[model samples]
Target: MSSFLTNSLKLLSGAIVAVALVTSAPALAAGGHGRKPVDPGFSFEGPFGTFDQGALQRGYKVYREVCSACHSMKLVSFRNLGQKGGPFYDPKYKNPNDNPVVKQIASEFETAEIDPDSGDEVMRKSTPSDRFPSPFKNDEAAKASNGGAIPPDLSVINKARNGHAPYIYSILIGYEPKPVGLEIPDTQHYNAYVAGSLATQWKGDPHHVPAGGVLAMPPPLTDGRVTFDDGTPSTLKQQAKDVTTFLEWAGDPHMVARKQTGFAVILFLILLGGVVYLAYRQTWKGHH
Candidate 1:
């Protein structure tokens, strides 16, 4: 009876150990799951990187040309493009000379007075110092412009939205003409991941539409809208990648630095853990 009771208690202890191991496995796995995949275009290896500089410049051009007509980048300044350590920005940046595009855009705006001591302008050519002014002076005007579709600010948009790179890229590339034969309900949209809640004011058929339902904005980039200067064939995918990367940089210019710092800290901790483990083993030698 004594031996039987002892065997039962041992079996119970083994079962408890097995249960503890099973429960702890998931928690250990959770720590290994790091950041989600960002949009590929933002990556150096992306197709956009073939002409990264030109892509960034062209993206800015696109913003100035078409996107600015609707959306406002209230956070970004023109000077930020000329700042140090940015993909587009060159600290030793030179002004575009005789560039018809730049000239045409610059012609519309007037420069303000420069401060003498600071040598900086009180107002410049919608520079980095200047916040991107909205096309509409007020909310009422903005509503009047786009059938009540208030164009969101582009600044920090990459950060605010989830699924980051891919989401933006998908939004840009996902534009398709309404398909026939498929009857989409008014409530359901063509989202890869549907939203839990939608606004009451949302009109238009959600089906046969982009992922973000009720986007009043039409397919801005159909094929051949913008040509790639690098002799690579211009495609919507390339455009999406370029624009997404440009936006990603704008969203978090310091991501690379931050990632590097984080990696360094992690390495230090790992080394410290190893050293402590070794010391512990040495101290416990011959104890058990």
Candidate 2:
């Protein structure tokens, strides 16, 4: 009887431990790489959805004023910004490359080129065709200035990572001070959405290991970091959402075009299916 009771108690204890682990697993694993991103309810989500031109413009402003300092968007050009699917597109302009706003924005930056007469490097005002300039001459230089961490380029970043648009938005707003008793490495900052791999890049102090890991990027966005020309509220969440939209557009400029094409194709197929069904029914009616 005593042996039976002891065995029963052991089984009960094991069952309790299993239940505890099952219940607490998600709680323990919350807020890391496993963390879920909040949906921004972006304008360009479903099959029929389209990008909001105003939001895109606001997002571009956020990137220009804040993210552009550290992140290079090498693939996007001033010309692309005024092209058909982009936010800045003007129906009145014969050629997007000749857009005055695009030209003005490009002219703000200096591009390096060989001077025809001197046969030497010269800095020249950019044209609409010119790509956005890199903040640093090279990766090593960027790393040296930013505490031994290389800032990733923003171009195609939305496509390169999982969670698509929300991931970028989440990382932008995920910054927080280190939790009590949690050791964060010097020169590193806390961000829940930051991938562990990005933290490993900052090999600053080997001894000053972060409790989980750290992001080399300091909190890049805050309330009112970039004031919108349209007077949208410059909250942290709003900034993050706006910048994410801009990056999404940059990664896939043809997204709207592609969506339109897909929709057209589906509609054509449906109509053809209906016509074919009618023809089949008529032909069979006479035979019957």
Best by lDDT: 2
Give candidate 2 regions above 4 Å deviation: 1-32, 197-213, 278-288
lDDT of 2 by residue, 1-288 (tens): 999999999999999999998989788664354246667888878887777888899999998898889889999998988998687888877688888888888899999999999999999999999999999999999999899888999999999977789878888887877655455567777766655633444455655544334677889999988889998999999988888888999999999999999989999999999999999998899688
- lDDT score for residue 266 of model 1: 90
TM-score of each: 0.62, 0.80
Residue 206's lDDT within candidate 2 is 50
Q: What is residue 71's positional error in candidate 2, in angstroms?
A: 0.9
Model 1: number of backbone collisions: 6
For TM-score, the strongest prediction is: 2
Worst 10 residues of 1 by lDDT: 188-197
lDDT of 1 at 27: 78
Candidate 2: which pairs clash? none
Clashes of each: 6, 0
